[model samples]
Target: MLKMKPVTRQKVNIVIDILMFVVMAALAVIGFLIRYTLISGEARWEKFGSNIEMTLFGLDRHQWGFIHLVLGVMLAVLLVLHIVFHWKQIICLFRRLTPLRPQRYALVSAITVVSLLILISPFFLKVELGESIRGQGERGGRNVSRTSGAYLPSESEDRTPLSSEVLNELPQTQAIHQNQNRRHGEARMLEIKGYHTIGTLAKNYNVSAAKLKNTLNIPSDVSSNERLGRIRRIYGFSMREVEECILALQHSTGDQTQHNNSQ
Candidate 1:
């Protein structure tokens, strides 16, 4: 390989050092914001909506993560280059170390422990489980349902609007959309009905299981057979939100049926 001139190599090293430092600083701030804001809000909002703008410096969490990943990879590459650049110095320093002894063994052990920690910290510190996306709720501006066909928000954020087709839906959707609570005996829980799953809930109410997933932000990979209690716990949102969305859809389907019958 053609050797780089000493002057050119030094300049490259300085530039890499600056880039690495800047990237680390940016990652620090982004990581902090993610920990405090995005991490907290994600669980709550996941069901409400996706593509929520968890912004810092005009970038959302997903965008920031992608950038972070790129920078991290770049930093790793730069580090390799840095080590190669310092190879001569490193060799001389090692050469100067006296005959390998107990002290040398101790030094190697210390370095190994430190390296292990540096590599392991991230795995334990991550917010989400496994490789799945997390954090979802009404916290970030997510009034609109994922299935706009099922539900649409009114011009006012306070009230949700029904699609024209939903006019045929049961009156329940309208009342609840206005933030009115459900009726006294609209019980749909484990107490009234033993262990309801998303599948049964959708089936009983005549709602779309697929759209319910979209509205509630249930990850596609999860089985419809997954119990509502489990869903509530895993998704980290109130059961109330899930119930309301289902009721609304049910009412819509009912109203459409009523309309058809009338015609």
Candidate 2:
């Protein structure tokens, strides 16, 4: 029988810590990217060459809510592990603080307390948070509408017409054209109202935010209203009635567009 070398518990613990740290770091980065992309309305590529759509479980806004819930649980678990591994250091730092250094202690305590409040506020307040130190709802240009689709404009006056020349200039225009060819060479224009954020759009469409973006060939990072404009330009559903017609066709026959013999 071959003798097996015993692995020290400390070494195992170290390995676990290293692995956990790597995972935690990755999760943090992913979470940050997701929030940033959603808030800023954009996308990023991961090391594995996957597109993280600022979405949950790779789904759209509604789907992302479920995904966010699951990810949040995983984040809590990782956070616990991080605390467990660093408890000794944390305790030591606390112990080192003394009344003699009242200012130092007060400063550290204030910072810690503020940080804690910032971290947990989103959960309690029912608002999304971001990595930026600025408080939630303070970010400029954030307009959330409950009734509009994900890409609808926040204000009626802010709405802009889709421009084909602008579309032709995009870096992904060639790829879009190729994809467009598969459906039809023609593009439709549409203007939609209701739902100002992707999350709202996902809920209204009964699809994931990611799917809507993918289906419309809109980048995850684009602003919500801009994305809607792109879809409108691509599909020629410039009006609500036309959009309704397209949707009706999709529901009635699973056909996005088909020629009518009468026409």
Candidate 3:
């Protein structure tokens, strides 16, 4: 039988160790990038004005996820090879752990089987569908709309610049009255979502934070920086209502501008 020299075996072990370390570090960084940088669809819309496909180095989140999976598989294979290389050491360690031969063998076998089963469980696991929050599934993570690469709502309740009835419910914004000469006709509909804050809406949509609060009938206690989603859950408001108020404010501003110009 052809045998590997001890020096060659040592070199191979060192290479495997280096590869494993590199793979682990890569996995950690990619995992953080996917979780924090790419973020969820709703969060992307809130931050980037739309559900723009988040990418790193020209690869989208799903593509990075695929690479992550490949790296995970490679790590698994490396681990198996590492174990094979050190099998004798493992056996010796097990012997030292327990004196009774039968008990030691049985315990080792049981632990090995259980560890493997835990690793394999994800494949066979039945994923239960939990009660989804409203608008949670509108844009699935990393699977956004292909058309225009922007989040397009169906003709549904969640649509931004919402219907007339909701808009009618909101009061006229103070900013519109305060800046009568300003051409709000140029004011565009903001891609508002529950993830946005009152401050964010005010800044991005060119509205008044105080007036927005009034339009939404938001409580005084809620901070401007607080997310609309959390505020809605507690205060019985909807993202639709927020969007309606924003559109109404824009319209009111424009109408006031037109009236002033005519005068």
Name the candidate that leads on lDDT: 3
Ranking by lDDT: 3, 1, 2
Candidate 3: regions farther than 4 A off = 1-7, 131-190, 193-215, 218-241, 244-263
lDDT of 3 by residue, 60-110 (tens): 888999999999999999998888888899888878889799998799799
TM-score for predicted model 2 compared with the true structure: 0.32
Candidate 2, residues 1-263, lDDT tens digits: the string is 99988997566667767766776676566566456545432111111111223444555544544555666667577667667767898768866774457777787789899989988897888667643221111231223222422222334334552233443344333433332212221122222342234455555554455545544555677555443444455544322222323232222222111223323
How close to the true structure is residue 243 of candidate 3, measured as C-alpha lDDT?
A: 56
Model 1 C-alpha RMSD to native: 15.9
Candidate 1 positional error at 157, Å: 34
Error of 1 at 262 (Å): 22
TM-score of each: 0.38, 0.32, 0.56
Worst 10 residues of 1 by lDDT: 184-193
- Between prediction 1 and prediction 3, which has the larger TM-score? 3
Worst 10-residue lDDT window for candidate 3 reads: 179-188
What total of clashing residue pairs does each candidate reach? Answer: 15, 21, 0
- Candidate 1 lDDT over 43-149, as tens digits, reads 43433333234566787766777877887888788788888989999767865693566767788789889989998998888675332222223322223333332
In model 1, the runs with Cα more than 4 Å from the true position are: 1-8, 46-53, 96-263
